[model samples]
Each structure stands twice: as structure tokens, then as C-alpha cells.
Target: MAAPDRPAGGGRMLTGVTWAVLLLGLWLWGRDITDGSGGPAPTTGDVAAVGRPIGVRLPPAHAPLRAAVPERVEIPSVGISAPVVPRGLDRGGGIEPPSFDTPQTVGWYDGGTKPGAAGAALLVGHVDTETRPAVFYPLSAAHPGEQVRVVRSDGSVAEFTIDDVQVFTREHFDAQKAYGPRKDGRAELRLITCGGTYDRATREYTANVVVSAYLTGGSGAAA
Candidate 1:
């Protein structure tokens, strides 16, 4: 089904200070990425359980694979399988998502850590389009323990095991928690999309849904 009309600018950007904060966080995240950084544990602040589901057993992280361009992403449980395109920062220093014309596509931050690398790899998609549900519209429904696979250009698949699902309101958005590495020595992934209640007045979603996962098991070899 279709959603309400979006602003002429686009679907994801927030307003004024909130937008600035997101941009700053993203910029710092890009600059701070390293093979292994003793970062904080990944958790959603609003959830009492702190992003972990009750008693779900997650797998241990696999050693990080070499850097390679991502070709596609697949989340079988949610029926998401889409082409991934590399994107860079916009003039305002914010990671630019795919153009609205390609709502079925996912955008990867080209300047940041690549999927299967030592740091968290960032992927973003649209929740919906002007005419229908987009690639990651059902992303919030994904649960911990599910798998997110990123097929890389090196002919290997980087398999990430979901450990957390979080929804951060603009006021409570913690970019580091959302974008940083969950564990210091493993490959991680961050899936993000617009979510929560839609604000007609602002023409935006009130929050962003972030899914955190780390490298689990995969087949093939990295180049």
C-alpha cells in the first residue's frame, strides 16, 4: 500500500538540529572506524531489555573477512532481497541514500567500512515509496537470531546474525549505538530505515528502526 505524500526533498532527513545531530554522528562514525575499536555494546536505549530479545541464543562472530564491495543484501525472513548501491556523503556531510526512483534498492556508505570488514557496515533503505511499500518496509518485523546476508564482489557471502532491533526517536537517537561496532573484533552490519509513527505535519517518520548484526557463518572466500 502507498504512504502519505513525502516532502519534495525526500523521505528520511529530519529537521534542523536533529538533522545536524545525525549528520555529525555519521561524520564521526566514518572518521572513527578502525579494524578493532573498544566501542560500547550495541543496544537500543528505549527498550528495557536493551535491544536483546528474551533468551534468544545468538551465534559467536566469525573472524572478519577482507574488504569487498557489496553486491546485494538478503533477509529471507522478511522477504527482502535487493541490489546494493554504493553511496557517499552529501554536501551536508550526511550519508546519502539511493534516489527515490530506486526505492527497491539499498544504499551502502561507500566511504565507511565495507560489509565483511572489521567494522560495522552500514546499509540503508526506504520503508516505503510514494506508491507502495519499499525494500525495507518490513524491516522492523525482523527479530533477533534471524540472518542478514551480504553477497560481496569477492564471491563470498558475509553472513551476519541479528542480535538487536531498535527504534530510536529523533530526540533519543544515539548514532554511535546505532552505527558503531557492537564487538571490537568482528564484522558488523547496521540496517536502517524510517519507522515509527508518521508525522503528517512534518512529512517524516518520528523514529528510525536500526537492526544490529555481526558476522556469523558464511561460505566462499574473500578476494
Candidate 2:
């Protein structure tokens, strides 16, 4: 994900032996994941990709925010339903991800817009941890029109529909685009995780898979 001090986020790691085994599996014909470049963790004001919109286009929402805290997040399409943890800046001033020990957890950037608020809300997770896939391993497969629900502590769910899911290389990561509003004044969401191939030399994925979505319907949504 393209955010402020990104190196501090997406803490998923693979030991040399583990990565080698995974790469060997890849060599036998498997999914292609890229190697990632080091950067500041993704911040809301950070991503803005240059060029044509790589994500799907969608209309803005007229709904207002009805909840301030998010509890759980569910993506039935991918069989993902996990706890949502509010994360803040790390010592390096980057968005921090949940510890790798809890690979099923997802982290939302507290400094950015809330999930149901009008703006881009970032939800980050690891595509895979050192030994296996994590909560967002299937994130890249999320398609347009799929539902992504965020259960709020207020007992309301903020629902979103996937609009776009694209992979951005670390070198070409547009902080503005990755974290920016796909459409002005829309209550949008960005689900990000490491993707592409792992680089043995750099010890990170080369690209990121970012899923863009917008508020659709939810009990917490404004009427």
C-alpha cells in the first residue's frame, strides 16, 4: 500500500528458507507476485497515481457517516471476516499493521477518513505472512460489485462495493491515487496488501494490490 512510511506497514515476512520454498512453488507454475520497494507507510494524503485511472469508476454516495468506530470487516466473496484494529503512526511516523502473529487481523488508518465518512479510508492487511497467506491473501481476486462490510462498534455496518482492484509497483505507487478519493466527495475505501513477486535480494514484494470501493448500503449509513 502507498502510504506514509510504508516500510513500517505490511509486516508480513518470509524467512529465507520459507521464501525459497514459496518461490520454488512459483517456479513450478503458480501465481505471480512482484517484489516491493521500501517507502513510507501509506497515509491518506499520500497516494496519487499519475495517468489514466487504473481502478473501476463509481458514483459517489449521498449517505452521511453514522458510525465513528469500525469493529469487524467481512468480505463474503473471499470468505474473509476478521477483526478490525485501529492503527496509528509508528515511531517512524508510518501506518502500522497488526503484528504478523495475528495474520487474520486488518488495520485501518486512524489518521485518515473513517470508513463511512466522505473520503478514502484505508484498510491494510498482509497478502501472506512468513509461512502462509494472511487475511487478505485473496484480496486481489475481489471483483467489482462485490460487497465489503465494516461492522462498527456502534452496532452498525458500513457496506461498500468494490469498484476497482489494481496492482501498483512500489516505484510507481501513486500515494494520491492509492490513498486519494477516486471520486470527489465519495465515501470510499482502499483495501491494500502486498502482491507481485517476492524479491530474494530485497526481501519484499515488488507490488501492491489495492482494492477501491465506495459506500453502498449499511444499517449505519445515513438515510
lDDT top scorer: 1
Best by TM-score: 1
User: How well does model 2 score by local distance difference test?
Assistant: 0.64
For candidate 2, give the lDDT of residue 40.
Answer: 22
**Model 1 local distance difference test score:** 0.75
Expressed as tens digits, the lDDT of each residue in 1-223 for candidate 1 is: 2333455444443444434555666777876753333001123455322346678998888988888999999999878999999989988778776777888899999888899988888998877655567788878778899999999998999998998887766676677887988777788999877655666576666666778899997778872
User: Per-residue lDDT of 1-223 in model 2, one digit per residue for the tens?
Assistant: 3222223333354334323333232222111111211122222322323222446565455475764777789999978899999887556445666778888899887766778888778788766665556788777667776889988877778889887766665554546555667776678888877655555556676566678889987784342
- What TM-score number comes out for model 1? 0.83
- Model 2 TM-score is 0.72
RMSD of 1: 5.4
How many residue pairs of model 1 clash at the backbone?
Answer: 0
